[model samples]
Target: MKATHQPPTTGDTTPADLLRGAALYIERHGWNQGAFFQLPTRHRLAPACAMGALRIAATGTTDSIILDDVFTQVLAAQAILANHLEPDYDHTTDLEADLNFEVISDWNDDGDRTAAEVVTALRDAADTWDRLHPTGGENA
Candidate 1:
């Protein structure tokens, strides 16, 4: 089957949507965004973008997200689309391009929303979920 590519900005407007989309993309690409020690310039492990997130989670630097864990990164990404997180996406890679799609930005444009903003938004949404006790009901 031909893999699906979601339209630009189709569902990823909110913070939750943005996070889920990013997480989904990372998961699909089999990327583990975490800290890696670049031996040539190593003081400690350095964080890589998506893999950095993973490394940080594995270590004690930051709290982890449900997305991209050893057992459930894939499912958590799907669940982020299905429930809890908002917006959602289909972040499949295209081998012809031989890279994950980059979220385009316009330097001439004026908006608070940048690629960094998108990542932040997603992380915030994930943090919010982490704050919530899933076992408790709505009042909790």
Candidate 2:
């Protein structure tokens, strides 16, 4: 089933908000097998965007200079996944051509870092975000 992409909007700019948005996007899009075909444009874009926001918060980095790098890493990861899934398919088209993937410019700048390192940092940031913004009334 095809659907129009709608970027999420909210007043909250916290890392938790970003993570939640990412998770929601993934949940709505489905991460299991055969789900890829059903993903909306924004859903395909969420992992990297969410990871970028989490990395920025975790490293306390400024968003200006590092976001490009973050996006690069995200695209790289997507490429890797795409290649893994289908070597003949051009996965970059979805990420590069999608108009809904907005480049965020308002965040602070953190130092340069690798996507591998960012993955670790994103994990910590996600944990912290979850702790700080627990759902179901659970203590953070």
Model 2: ten consecutive residues of lowest lDDT: 100-109
Candidate 2 on 93-122: residue-level lDDT in tens?
544423212221111112343334334333
**lDDT for each residue of candidate 1 in 42-113, tens digit (9 for 90 to 100):** 333322243333223323232343333321332332233223222344332222111111221121022543
**Candidate 1 displacement at residue 22 in angstroms:** 12
Q: In angstroms, what RMSD does candidate 1 have relative to the true structure?
A: 13.9
Instruction: Output the worst ten-in-a-row residue range by lDDT, candidate 1.
Output: 96-105
Q: Which structure among the candidates has the greatest TM-score?
A: 1
Clashes of 1: 11
Q: Give residue 82's lDDT in candidate 1 (0 to 100).
A: 26
lDDT of each: 0.32, 0.34
